[model samples]
Target: MTDQAHSLSLPRWKEPSILPGFGVGVGLTLTYLGLIVVLPLAALAIRPWELGLSGVWHELAAPRVTAALKLSFGLSALAALLNAPLGLLIAWTLVRYQFPGRRILDALVDLPFALPTAVAGIALSAIYAPNGPLGSIAAKVGIKTAYSPLGIFIALVFIGLPFVVRSLQPVMQDLDAEVEEAAQTLGATTLQRVIRVVLPALAPALISGVSLAFARAVGEYGSVVFIAGNLPMKTEIAPLLIVIKLEQYDYAGAAAVGLAMVAISFTALVAINAVQTWFAGRGRA
Candidate 1:
């Protein structure tokens, strides 16, 4: 009995299972992760230190680098925030209501995922250029659409939308209409029903979608470059700056910029995850 209790108290390295090769599976998983994820990240972390701490700081604090980082992270976050509600609405509509051309609309959501980034960038630039239809209309209003920060925002939103939609679709499908009906029967208004009944359950998936969209937008290069005009201290982005550094054969400088991005991105993701956890706990309570 004591031995059994002691065994139960001890941590199990792996769960008990009828399936064989648990040890082999664990070994393979670790090996794959180390090779693909850990080693590369470790190398990146190590490379930037070739620049001493002050050198890394100087690289990050340069005016062009500062502006680029701000533009990349700021627009990425704003795009993700905007995508949340729009994607949720689209997901809810696709799941709850059948309409003419519903299948076509559903298929279009995945178009960005399928399209090459360079092609998408070119398309966006053309459509938003000064002489293009939308650009002409914007120019009439004294707004520059292409070759500006707004253009960067547009490109980020385009690439990030699918992440939000795909993440929420499965969760939306599993959400029951009956609970909403119950809330309505208990004197909840449509808005109240949505706020009180629907949102809590959807929160985790929504946050995950936003996180993915933000991360994707931050690292985005191909789609944004054409639209952004690559103006230093204006429309330029961190990833683009990294490329310029590499082209100049400034490996340490590139690594410094890359390291700064990683740190900021990781911090933002951690905060998002913390919010997700809080929402999850609140829902359970």
Candidate 2:
């Protein structure tokens, strides 16, 4: 009776499962995360403080660093926003319609995922160079495409589109067409059905995709470096600035910039997740 009471008093750590070895699985998972993720981030966080708080602040306060951070974060957010609607359109088309070459188009959406960033940058640069086809057309209109912030925006959009598309595809596939048909039968207009019925169902996945795209764009280096022209206070990005700092043997300064980027990115992602949570709650309510 004592043993039975003692066992009943013990807290349940997890639900009963048919599968065994939960302890082993959790131990391995934590060990893997500690070594692979926690250790590196700990190193990054500690390295910057070697410069002291003031020194770290000074490094990040530099005009060039400020500009690069702004450009990188700003354009990354913009690119993610643009990709939301465009990716939704593409995913909708792929999942809802059948047409010639639809399979090819769906496969092509994953091109950015497989392509090397440097190769993508080079191709984009060539296409948007002043004398190149699209570049020539843009230049004729007194606009610059390559070697500018516009170019950085383009590169980000290129890399980010795949995230949004792929994230939405599975959700899109699961969405029943009969729901839309039912709405239509209720005399709902196409726009009304989409805005009310479809968007609510898709909001979570869409936000997740946008967050992923933003995160990827924020850290992008190879693809952006080639087209950014690496100009100071103009088109340079934070990752490129960190690289320049490392090349100049300013390890502390580089770490400081990296730390700042991590902080900002974390804050932004938190905000996005909060919105996602709110949306999920509203949907449930």
Candidate 2, 168-262: lDDT as tens digits: 99998999999999999999999999998999989999999999999999999999999889889999899988988899999989989999999
Steric clash pairs (candidate 2): none
lDDT values for all models:
0.94, 0.94
TM-score of 1: 0.96
TM-scores of all candidate predictions against the true structure: 0.96, 0.96
TM-score of 2: 0.96
**Residue 100 lDDT in candidate 2:** 100
State the local distance difference test value for candidate 2. Answer: 0.94
The C-alpha stretches of model 1 lying farther than 4 A from their native spots are 1-10
